[model samples]
Target chain A: MKRNSTWKTVHRYGVYNKSTGAKVSLTGGFGYDYTDGSTATRGFISPNGAWFDNPTVAFTAAAPTKAVTAQNEAKTPYTLSWAPGKLSKKVAVVEALKASGPNFFTAWVDNGGEVDVRITNNGGTYEAKYYTMGTSTQIANPFTASVGDDSSSPIIASEITSNKWLGWMHSPEKRTQIYWAGGASISFYQETNMSADATLLGKTNGAGNTGYTTLYAVENRAIADATKFPVEAATWVASTTDAYEYGRVNASADVRFYFTALNPPAGKLARTLYLDVNPAGPDAGDKAIMFNFSANERSKEYTSFAATPVTATLNKTGSNLRISNGHTSPWSLGIQRWQVLLTPHFTSGALVRLGGTTQ
Target chain B: MIALKADGTVYAMSEPMVLNYVHAASKDMNENKEIVFVKEDGNNHNPVPALCTAPTASRHYPGGTTDVVVCSVEPSDFGTKTYKLRYNGKWVNGLPDMEGRNSENDKNGFRVTMVNPKAGTVVTHTVGGVTTNYVLKPLAVAEAFLPESNAALCNDINFTTVAQFGWSMSDLPSATMIPTAIPNLGQSAGTSKFEVLGRQWRRISLSIRAFS
Candidate 1:
C-alpha cells in the first residue's frame, strides 16, 4: 500500500482477507508506507500478493489460523461488539476472536462453525491454524455487577483509609457541625479536610430548618451503569421547636429523612436491607415528638419516650423501616438530644446498626 | 485543535487510536508473574499447611515429576514470598522460566497457579488412572503444590494453564438497539451507552493486556 499512488487521496483502506474473504478496515490517511513484507497477519491486511488496483481496496495474502481446542473455550480472548473497534460499528453482535504471538492477531466468527482458538509455544515459535467448534455455547461473564462503595453522601475524603470506610458529617444547615470517625466524634466538619462549601450528594435543608443530620452507605446487589448508578444510602435528622398555648410541645413531631436511589429503574432495584431503630414512632397518645423513618412502608410505633438512647439495627433482608411519632399532651420546653453512632459490618446478616443516647 | 478550560489552562485532546497504540505497546504477559507477599491467617482451613506456612528457607523438591506447582498464600504483607523451584529431581531454590518462552528443558518445569474456584468446590483432573481433587476452601490461602505437601489433601500437581479472556457487556443494550447519535445534547450525549468511553478507559488500564 502506497500513499497517493493513484494520484488521488485515500482516507481509509479496507483490507480484504484473501483466505476467508472478510474485510478489516484500517484508518490511515497519509504518510503510511507499506512494503512487501511489512504487512500484518491474522485478521489484518497482508499485502504480499498483487497490488491494489483500486485505491480503497488493498489486496492481502491469506491470513494464518490456529487449531481450536473446544475444552479451552473458557480462556479465549474476543471482542464484544460494544467495545471500540470495527466490531463496534457492526449491527450484529459479532465477536472478533484474538490470538497473541510476538504480533497481535484478529479473527472473525461469522458462521456457527468459527470458534476462537488460542495456541502458544513457549519457545516463541509463530505458527497459526484454524479449527471449528460446531456445537458449543457462547462465552459468558460470571458477574454483571460493577461493585464499589456507592455511598449516599460525598465521602469525606480524609476519613477514608481502608475499604468500606464510612464517613459522616452534619449537614451545613446545622449550626453545630459534627463528623464521625469509627463512631467517635473526630472534629467539626468545617475544621476537617473536607471543604465547608462542598456540596453533598443529595439535597440538604438550609440553616434553621430540619436537614440531613446523618448519612450512611449501603451495599446494592447490582448496578447497571456504574457511571449513573445512585449511591445507596439514607439521611436522618432531628428537629426541636417551641410550644404554643397547648403547653410543652417543644420538639416537632417529624424527623427529616431521605433515601438515595430508593426507586431505581425496573430490574435494577438496589438490594433492600431493613433498618430497625429503637425508641422510634408514629404515635399520637402520650409521645411529644414523633420520629418517623419510612422504608418499604414498614412502620414501628413506640408510645412513650424513656431515658434510653436511640438505636438502629438491621432487620431481615428484603425489608424496610418506617418510624413515626405523635403528640397528644404537652410537656416541658427543654430540647431532646439524640446522638446516633452507626456502624456497618458487611457480613451474613448485613445490618447497618446505630447506637446513641437520647436525653 | 485544542480548547481551553474556564480556568484558561490548555486541554490535551488525543486521538483514540493513540491510546490503543500505547496500550498495545505496554502489553506484557509476565506482568502478573510476581511474588505477592501475604499474612497467613491461622483460622483458614489450609489443605497444605507445609506449603502455606511462612517459609524460613527454601524447601527441596522430590523427584521425577514433570511439573512443579507453586501458590502464594492470601493476606500477604505485601513483599515477602516463596521463590523456590526444582530441576531434574533436585531443588533449584528460585523461580525459573515455567512458561518457557526462552528456555525449554526436558526435566525442569515450574508454575505458580492461583485458583479462585468457588468455596468448597472440588475440581478434579484425572490422568493415567490417578484422580486428584482440588479442594478449594473459603479463603484458604494456598491449597496444593508439588511433591505432595499433604497426603490427606489431594497431592495431584498438574494444574498450570492460562487463557486470555475479554470484556463482556451483559447488561448494556446491544449495538443494534442504540441509535448512532441523539437529537439533543442532553438526551443523546448523556445516554448510558455513550458513557462507556470513560468506563472503557478504566477497564483497559485495569485489566486489558495488549493483544500481543
Candidate 2:
C-alpha cells in the first residue's frame, strides 16, 4: 500500500441568496475527509446556537464526536450505489463529491457516510453500488397471502428491488426504467469493529466472479432511486417525484433537499423547507414534517398548506429535515428556521451498505 | 185695480184683488207699485203667474179647521208688477230678496224702521238722489229697517208734522178729545176764550215702520 496524503482546505465555499442576502447551509450536511482521515473528523462544525446565525465553522484538531443525534437514528439506514469508469476522469468526476463536500451531499456523518462501497460488471457495463448502515435491523414483510400491507417498503421482492433487474436488465427501455431491487442481506456490516483488521467478503481475483467487490457499513441508508440526486458531474435528474424544483442530488451525499412549493418563487424565488417534528399525534407517532418557508409570514403555512407526506420506509434517508419549534420563515425567529446541511459525493458505481449487490 | 189712499183706507177691486195690503196703513209709505212677489231662478215654473193681480200665497190647506182662503190664481204677475227696491246698501248688486213663493215671511224682503244712530254709526239712507249723515253708537245689531228710526237713534230727532221740517208726520186730537173738551164736546161750548192759553197735543207714539 502507498502512503496517504494530508488534508487541507483546497476550495472553501459559502452559500447566499440574492433575495434575503443571507448565507445558509443545507440540512444534515455531512463532513468530508481528505485522503488521510484527519480532515474528515473535524473542521466546519455548525454553530452551537440556532439557525438564523451563521453556521459557525470551527477548525480544531478535536475529532467529531460519533455519538448519534436524533437525526442519526431517524435516518436509520443509508445506501450508496454508482457506475465505475475505466479512466481517472470518470473516476475523478465521481470521486470529487467524496473528496470535497459540495452543495449536493447530504448527511451529518463527518465522513460523507461510512460508505459501504462495492463494484460490479453487468456483462460489459461496469456498475458500482454505494450504501451505509442504520441502527435498525431488516424488518419482516408484515404481510400474508390474504392481506399484504407492505407496498410502501423501500425494498420490493420481499427484499430490496431495483429496476432493470425486473426483466433481468432486458427491457426495450424507453423511459419505463422503473423497478425496485436491494433487500436486507444477512451479512451486511456483520463484523462489529472497523478499527481492527478486517476483510471484505470477496477479493478482486476471487472465484470466477472476482469482477464484483461487496462492501458494508453500519447504520447505513440506501439512497433509493426515488430519493437519490446526482449533481452535474455525471449529473442525474433526481428521480424524486416530490422535489419542489428540478434539481439533482448525489447518492453518497445525505442532506434534505431544500425546495419551494410546486409553485416556486416567481422571478428569483428563495424559500426554505423546514423539518418540524410533529408532536406525537393521536397515533403517538411524532413524525417531522418538511415545510417550505418564506421570509414573510409564509412559514406558518408549512403545517397546513404546501406540505408533502413521505413514506415511513423512506423516512429520513439522511436527507430529511428538522424545523425547530421556534424557527420561522423570512429567516427570522432565531430557532424556527430551515437549518439543514447536505454534503454530496459521487458513487463510482459501488454496491455497498445494508441493501446492496447480492455478492 | 185697487186704491191705497194715504188716509189708511185700503180698497180693492169689487172682484177681490188686493190694493196695497202691506204698505196701506204704514207710515213712511208712498204710492210705489206694491211689489207683491218677485219670482227668481228665471221662475219658469208651472203655469206662469198672471200679469197684474197677486193673490196671497197658499199651501195644501191640508186640514179640517178654519183656514184662510189663500188661493193662487188671482193674477200674481211678477214680471209686470215688480217695484225695484232702492238698494241703498254698500253691497254690490244689493242683497238678494228671496223669491216670491218663498218670501211670505223671508227676512230679505223690503224692510223699514226708525233709529237715532249713535256717534260713528252711519245714518245715510238714499232717497232719490239726496244723501244725509246721522252718526250713531256702535252695536252688534244689524243695519236698521226704517231710515226714520235710524235717524232718530243717531240724532235724537223727533217725529212731527211733515210740513214743518220733513223729519216726521202725525196728527193732533180733534175737538172732542181736546184738553178743553169744548164744555160739551162742541167747538163753541168752551168757557174761557179770554183767559185760556194752551199748546197743541200730539199722537200717542210714533209709527216708524217699513215703507212700500
Candidate 3:
C-alpha cells in the first residue's frame, strides 16, 4: 500500500517521516546505499517500516496562475483571468518579472478576472502591452492603437512652432506717449542783471524806476480840472478901491451918504459888503451908521445905535446900499470918517466889478 | 418914676409926686415909664436873659415842671430895687409885681405845673408875662388784648406766656398762640408746611404743647 508522506531524506541529524511522526537518528550505523555513490546513504522508510534507498518522490507546490484571452475585432485589448483566492490581497501586473516597470499595472484583488487598462504610446510609434507582476508573462494582446501621451505632463519646447511662441511677446506698437501743456515761461534767478523789452499787460513803472523796469510809465496829476485834464495854478481877481468922506450933524439928526452905482455883474451874485465908521469930538456920546438902498433894492443895516469906530458886514443881496448916521440921543454934531466896501460872487473865469461910498 | 433935668442931672420921685409936678409945670409934660423882666433856666445856664414883659399882680410861672428862685437882693430896703435870680450859677432879672412881692412859693422856688398832664399834653405858661408852650411826654407801656382768659386753647401744648418788661411788642410779640392743634407735637415734622411759622418766630423762644 502506498501512503502519502512529507519527509526529508537529507537532514543533518537523520530523517523524519511526516506521515508517521517518526524521527530516525543518523548516528546509528544504518548505512544504506542510493543512486549516486557509496557515500550517498540517505533513504526513506516505506509504509511497512522497511527502509527504501530511493527517497525521491513525485510532489509539487501550488502557485498562483493566470490565463489570458486573445484579442479580437470585438475586444481590441486582451484580458487576464485568475482564480479568486485571497480577495483582500492586492494583485498587480508587471513586466519582465519586476515589481515596478513602465508596463506595470495594479488593481484590487476583488476585481475578479476583469480589469480595463488604458494604454498610451507615450509619444512613440510602438504599441503598449500589459503583463503580470514579477513574471516574464504577458497578456495575449499587444495593442497597436496608441491613446497618446498624458495631456497634464510638461510640454517640450519643440512641440510649439516659432510663430505661436511669438504671439505671447508684448508689442512695442501699443506703448503710450506722454504730453505736457504749453504755458508762460517764468524765469527764476538767484543773482542776475536782466534786460529785456517785454510788454506787461496790467503793470506800470512806479516813481524812480530803481531796479525793475516796467512797460507803462506813471506821472502825478493830483490837481486837475473838471474834465480830468491838467492846467496851471489858480489866480485871484483884484479888489476894487474903497471910498471915504467926512460929515457933521446936530444931536438926534441924521447924516446920510449914498453909493448909487453899487451893483453886481451878470451871471454873478453879490457876496459881501463891509462898512467902517469913526467919530471925532468929545460931545458925540454914541453914534451909529445905517445903509439904505433904493426902494426897488434890498436894504442892510450895519448898526442900530453903536459907539464910533464900528465895522460890519452885509451878505450878498442884489442891491446898492446908502450909508448914513443913525438918529439917536446924545449925538452932537461931529466930524466922522466913514468907508464902505462891496464885493461880488464870481466863478473862476468870470469878471467882477464893485462900487461903494465913503463918508 | 425917673426924670432927666435940663442940667443933665437924674432925679427919681414918687409916681404921684412926679405926676403932680408935671401937671403944675406944664400940661404937655407926661410921665413915661417901662419895665422889663428876664428869666433863665437852671439846666441851660444861658448868659443872655430871656426878655419878657412886666408881670401883673397875679404871678405868671414858666411852663413845665422846672423849679426856679430869686436868691439875691443887693439893696433890699429900696422898694424899686433890682432883684436877681441865680439860676445854675447865672444871674437873671426877677421883676417884682406892683405890690413889691417877688418871693418864691417854696424853698425850691417856683414849680410850674400843667393841669392834666399826659403824653403829648401841651401847656402854656407866662414867665415874666411871655407865654411859652411845653409838651408833656409820658413813658410808653406796650399792651395786647387776649380774647378770652382760658377758654381759647393754644394749639401748642407746651406753650407758655412771656413777660418782656422794657421791650416793645409792636409787630412780633414775644409769645404767639395758634388755634389749631399741632399734628406732630415735640417731634420732627416736614418743614415745608411750617417754614413760614418758623421764620415768623425766628428770634423768639418756641414751645409746642396743648393748652387751654
Candidate 4:
C-alpha cells in the first residue's frame, strides 16, 4: 500500500522526455526516457515479466476498473499482455495478456471450481471479484510458414502506403527490408519520413523467414523464447494486413493486425481519441474519451479536442486546437489511454503538456 | 509420427520431410478452411509420379503411407513443412503426414505428396519423428487423394461458441487423428482403424490457434 516513490510532481503540461522539447535525435537509441524509467512501481523489471515502460504488461489503477470499459472496436487490437512487478494493481489479470497476434483473450467465463477466482474493485469503493472459466495457456504464433521476402522486386515506398495499413514488424540484424504481406499489397510506413537509404528497424523476425516487421517494439525479453507453454505474444505485429495471399480466411481466420507511431516526440504529449470535442460544446474535458489514434494534421485543419480538468484551469481560451487530419484516418484514435505500462500499474497522465516541455 | 491406416496396419514413416500445401486466401475463414484432393471430372486421380525434391528416392505418395493436411506447406512462399513416417531404427519421412495448423474450414482443398532425399533439411522441419516398424496389414487404395480424384467435400469441421459452446474468441481447441483433425469427420465413429500395407496414404490433421 506504499505510494510510488519515483512519481515526480504532477505536471500541468505533460510527462517528461529523455530529451528536451518535442525532438528525438533518431540517431542513437532515440533519447526517450520513459515516465517510469527505473523504479519499483513504475520500473519495467518484474519477477513475472519485466514491463518497465512496456505497454503489453502495463496496467491502470483506475476504479470501476475504468480502463477495461475504455475498450472500443478497433481496426487494430489493443495488443496488451501481463507484466507483473512482483505486485500489480488489476487483481484478476494474473499474467499480462496480449491484445495482438496469436495471444488470445475473450470475455468472462465460469471456473466450475477447477479454475481460480480473482477479485477487484469494479470502480466501487469495495473490491470486486471474477472467476475465470476453463483453464487456459498461451499458444504459438500463426505465421509459422516461412514467407519469402518480396524478392526480385523493389516496390515504390509510396505504393506500400496506398492501401489498408497491414500490420508490420522489424527484425534486428542486417536483414533490413519492408514487406507487404497478406492477401493484397499491405501498406507499411506511411510517409517514409527519412530519405531513401536510411535503413529501418522494428521487432526482429524469427527463423522461419518471418522476422519482425517495423510496426512493433519489444516490451520484454522473454516473450520471444519459443520453448514456453506457447502463451506469449510479446513479439506479435499488431497491424492488419489486407493483402493475404492465401487470401483471407474469412472473418474467422485468426488474422489480426496493428500499427504504432514513434513514442510521442519526447517532451511533447499526443493523445489518440475515438470521440472529438465539439467546437461549440461545454468546456472541453467535459466529455469522456473512448479509443486512440496516431495521426498528424496540418494545413488549414479544423479539429476540436477536450481534456479533463484536474485542479481546474483559470483562463480557458479554446483549450482545444484545430489541426488537419491530413492524409491519415482517425478511425479509432485512442492512444491517449495508452501509457508506458508500469508492470503493476499503467498511468495515463504520463504524457507531457502541449507545445511546452515539462516546467 | 506413425500414421494409422484404415485396414488396421501400422505404416512406418518411411520419409520425414515437410510438404507445403496452400489454398486460396479468402475473407470468410470458416468457409475457406477446406482442403480436398479431387479430380477434374471422371479422372480417377493423377498421382505425382515421384514425391521428393531429390529425384534419387525410388518411392513417394503411392510408395507407402503419407499424412496430408490443408495449410501453407509451400516451401517457396512459406517454408517447407514436415511430412514424415516412421521406419527402420530411425524415424523416416516415408510414412504418412501431420495435422493441418490452419484452424477454420478447409472443406474443399487437396492433398498431394512430397519427399526430400537430402539429409540436412530446413531447421525445425523433417519427414517423420519416431517409428515402430511392425507392419499390421494393408490399406485400401483411397482414390480420393489424387488431383483428379473427385473433390470430396469435407463438411463436418465446426468452431465458434455460437456454432458450438466453449470456444471463445481466444479458444485454443485442437484435434489430432489419422484421417481428420476435427472429430466431426466420418472416422470419428471409430470406423477407420490402423493399416500398414497401402498404395494410397493416410493423414493426421491438427488445428491450433494462430492468434487470439
Residue A357 of candidate 3: its Cα lDDT? 26
DockQ of each: 0.01, 0.00, 0.00, 0.01
lDDT of 3: 0.21
The number of clashing residue pairs in model 4 is: 133
Clashes of each: 23, 87, 13, 133
Q: List per-candidate RMSD values in Å.
A: 32.5, 63.0, 81.4, 31.1
Using DockQ as the measure, the top candidate is 1
User: How do the residues B35-105 of candidate 2 rate in per-residue lDDT, one tens digit apiece?
Assistant: 23333222222223222134334521233222212112222222222111211111111111222332333
Model 4's chain B TM-score?
0.16
Q: For model 2, what is the error of residue A274's alpha carbon versus the real structure, in angstroms, after optimal superposition?
A: 22
The candidates' interface RMSDs, in order, read: 27.9, 75.1, 96.3, 33.1
Model 1 chain A is weakest, by summed lDDT over 10 consecutive residues, at A81-90
Per-residue lDDT over A141-212 for candidate 1, one digit per residue giving the tens place of the 0 to 100 score: 111223221222212233244422232222211222233332212343211111011121111343321121
Which stretch of 10 consecutive residues in model 4 chain A shows the poorest summed lDDT? Answer: A350-359
Runs of candidate 1 with Cα error greater than 4 angstroms are A1-200, A214-353, A356-359, B1-113, B116-212
**Candidate 4 deviant stretches above 4 angstroms:** A1-61, A64-359, B1-212
Model 2 spans with C-alpha error above 4 angstroms: A1-117, A122-322, A325-359, B1-212
Candidate 3 ranges with C-alpha deviation above 4 Å = A1-359, B1-119, B139-212
Query: Distance (Å) between predicted and true CA of B49, model 4?
Result: 26
Best by lDDT: 1
Compared with the true structure, all predictions reach lDDT values of 0.23, 0.22, 0.21, 0.21
Q: State the lDDT of candidate 2 residue by residue for A122-201, as single tens digits.
A: 33322223333211222223223222223232222433322322212111111112121222111111111111001221
TM-score order, best first, reads 4, 1, 2, 3
